[model samples]
Target chain A: MEENDVKNRFKAVVIGGSAGSLSVLFEVFPALNPRLNVAIILVLHRKYSGDSSLSDLLSTKTSLPTKEIDDKDPILPGHIYLAPADYHSLIEKNYSFSLDVSEKINFSRPSLDVTFESAADTFGPSLVAILLSGSNDDGTAGLKTVKEAGGFIIAQKPETAQMPYMPQNAINNLEIDLILDSKEISDFINMLNQ
Target chain B: MIEDEEIDLLLNDVFEIYGYDFANYSRASLKRRIIRLFALDKFPSFAELRYRVRTEEDYLKRFIEEITVNVTEMFRDPSFYKVLRTEILPVLGTKPFIRIWHAGCSTGEEVFSMAILLQEANLLKKSLLYATDLNPSVLEKVRKGIFPLNQMKQYSESYIASGGTKDFSTYYTANYGQAKLNEDLSEKIIISTHNLVSDSSFNEFDLILCRNVLIYFDKDLQERALKLFDESLGVLGYLALGSKETLKFSTIQARYKQLDKEKIWKKTM
Candidate 1:
């Protein structure tokens, strides 16, 4: 499949990471290809509850409009949505967000598996999911769900990751479609714009 | 395993036959929960799921409970509770009788937390905590005032974080891995079933906390619920929403003064 045939091919791009993921985001968001106009979602492992500083911190790294997700908030194109702390953020079928205060998965709220699996139910083939650096095994199962749903899956090249367990686990267990480093990651996502 | 149209069909059948209105719930969360229930019961097809809901009276109860999220904890957001203690409750204390309505009070965690706050402030006996939910199964738990024992450690941490001073264990008695909350706390609570979609305001209140409930409703339903809250609040009353939810876009925004901290808003008139 031609990767650049991505015009209208996707509706939302979900990015899940932990540990060294912030540095990778800093690297990727600075030169993002603006042509890619789909919801860019980030689910990261963090401790603080409802930290607006994280949004303020990430917003300076990119030009895309970013907001912390509230329940029932619409998932719009070309926007960046951060999952709030201490709740499992689930994407609804109507292109909106919902929150659950259920028990943690893999010792973390905002589990990548929860969001990716829910996003798979909604976006299906148009869902492009990316797994980045992390110490735990949260995103692997979610990436598998995306794969089974026929969504595109990308993983950070293990050596390029500060904590490679997460992306490495996906690469080890699932049939990952693309493997990328921090430098190549932005270019690949930007290429999806075409 | 449920199809989109089948969900609509089941929702319609449940409403038409049982008089339960879930048609306006935010479809995403509703569908996801429905799907979870379907798989948990191991129904092979949507038809079986539909048949069970329609034919079995007891199954309908289970279906409703599953669709509505009841996974809550005491002081789930400790900071929100902190503001409630330091800022919101202090003013409401001056009233002769404090009436608080915990709308969509699932499993009654937040209500108990409020009761603890009131008790700590030496106001529980004079306060009426009206805890309501659409599901009666949970209201029974609220009445019983029991919760899983394992959760107490986390709740204790949150309790301290929320500026609770007493030993948290003093609030409940434990046996067989279940903690029964103090009767004194439950003493002030009135548990009932009230559907936000169909129910009207029953009493005016000093503080109304409908946290994380409106997120499940569609825009029109959210507006309707907000209006109901407006009608239920007296002048200088406080209205609290979930952290992410706002009264800013609603019609009642102009009259309410948002507090400097938290999502609490005070009704000026």
Candidate 2:
């Protein structure tokens, strides 16, 4: 599919990563248009509880309004939602988020796989799943679900990732649509807005 | 997409037939669970599932279990238990008799964790732990106090992190891939069924641990539960919530004060 066709088809975008994700997000968020008509969900692994500073930090770098997800919060267009620490945020069919305190998967709560799989189930062909830099293979299975659901899948190029295991796993296991660095990812999201 | 009317009708039928009130639950979570049930049971549509739920006696039992999210572990959040041990328990020790309620205590992992905590603090002899849940099946499991042996390793780690002084293995005996918690711990525990949504508070409590349960409730229901908690707690009693949950937005927010970073709040008024 053409880039413009893919852009128009998308309704939601989900990005998952752990280590080395902050800098990449800083680069990508600034480049995206502020008024893009799509909801963006982020899942990043953290070692502690109550660290909600992530949303505030991201808001400073991006024009899109960012907030930590509250349970049952509605998904709105042109807004950025970050999964709160220590909860697995699932995208419900009603286009709202449900937080679960289930046992951690892949040794992480706010599991990348959990959010991506739920987003795939909810948005299906209209979703975009991005696997970014991380030290673990958490997003591979989730990216596979997105690919099987006919959603576009992007994996940060392995060499470009500060910690490549996560994106590299996705590239090896799934048929990813795009493999781009942080700058290219920024440009890709910018293109989607146009 | 399932229509709003269809969901309302289905929930009304569930309440009328099963006496389980899910009307006030967060709609998104309820809908997702229902959809998941439909997919899991291979029901073609919500109407078909609703028919089965209304008519089939055995199906309702499984349906209830499926809809209720029971994701808990022993000492699930070690820091919360740490706070209870280092700070809260010492204060509660001054009471003539301590009453601790574990609301929505699914399968009793945390309740057992609490029992162990109280025992370690030398308060078990004078303390009474009331563990309650909406699901009878889970309450039965709580009464038995047997957990999968595989989880003991993880539980031991959490126990240590929560400032356990004794060997964690001494609390339970493993056999046939299951660990039976020491029977002495059950002496002071009373397991019963209580619905936070529909049931009134049975007794005032010194400490109430209702962690991770409120996240499944909507704002109104959360307020209702909080009000119930406030009424059930004695003045200066402690209420422990899940790490992600907060009383800041609740209607009774001013009635409590944060006692620690681990989400322990004390009822002041």
Candidate 3:
């Protein structure tokens, strides 16, 4: 259960957050070692039909390379992948991203639950699910699946989150591993990796 | 019996008897619709529903309604159609002859919308619009080109938002409670039944509109339909989707570039 042990085991990291998530991303992305041999995937809830330039918007705040994943691109270390605005993006065992137009759940196509569950299934114990700021409890069930599969689960401290529905739901749904504010969260993630 | 098994059986029976395939549709939506069908048909059991659909005429009609997801209206998204008119039309206007495919055309409203746009753009004379859907009943209604006259008031507003140049009422004639579209409009369209899931591409087209249709399909089905669209589109052909659909997760995403964020993508080799 050591943090370094968790980091050494995972080949990649997966994070799910929404609503007031940009602040969390700014803190988290810069803390991880740029030289770590691990890829990062972030899922942010977005309006189903709006134009989203999240990857472009995030690129300016982090030194890590960021791009909206295209179909079947191999997941590589030193890069960050952002799911596009309206589709659920999944990672195959081959490390390529798969896009799906399957019917929406809870009226959203790019459901956090879809991305997190699929990632947990694909990566098993190597995966980490984080629920941050959001208006809905979208990632609660998915984060539970990750925890049940012996993966890591983290939530933003509800009082620190701009929208607390998501982090609070994750906490109420499962016995999560860690709950921290943005400052403490970055330090914990970095220390875990080291 | 588990609901999954019952749905599998229903899909099997549909394929075996009607030659229609629902096997590849997203499981959640398909299951929901089948449940609605059962409720509407008053079938006491899944077996009874299957038998009635297999044998009874009235049941088959009801089954078609449940199976076909026709959520559409005239100019459903005004801004998208606005872009289609201002940006897409100019490119389409250059072609001496144009063939457009309105895939998944439901109730013919969108096909008629495109036809009206073409007519105003001075391109209808040299244009051929093929409007297709999997539901034969909807296709038949589309061929008739008559819509409930009451809906015309709302459609007129959409038409204006899409940048109508003339009176929207001029495109159709009111008869009793129905509005019959201009014969000239119908002349430009060929309405037929074509299942995107089970059918192959019929011909190369200058533009293909498969809006709000793929969201009902699973990943495999979406990729199949995307490949079909890619092949069916001629060089520099255009592909338009519902605002909620995109090429981002398809195997062919690299083969397209967003012409507009509103889901207009141009075919790229």
Residues A103-166, candidate 2: write the lDDT tens digits. 6879998899888888887899989899999999799988988888888999999898899888
Query: How does model 3 score by TM-score?
Result: 0.68
Query: What are the Cα lDDT values of the candidates?
Result: 0.89, 0.87, 0.79
* CAPRI class of candidate 2: acceptable
Report the poorest 10 consecutive residues by lDDT, candidate 3 chain B.
Answer: B27-36
Scored against the true structure, residue A48 in model 1 reaches a CA lDDT of 67
Give the best candidate by TM-score. Answer: 1
The residue pairs found clashing in candidate 3 are A99-B249
Q: Using TM-score as the measure, name the better of candidate 1 and candidate 3.
A: 1
Worst 10 residues of 1 chain B by lDDT: B26-35
Give model 1's DockQ, 2 decimals: 0.58
Error of 3 at B47 (Å): 13
| Per-model root-mean-square deviation over C-alphas | 1.8, 3.9, 6.2
Candidate 1 vs candidate 2, lDDT winner: 1
The DockQ-based order of candidates, best leading, equals 1, 2, 3
Arrange candidates by lDDT, descending: 1, 2, 3
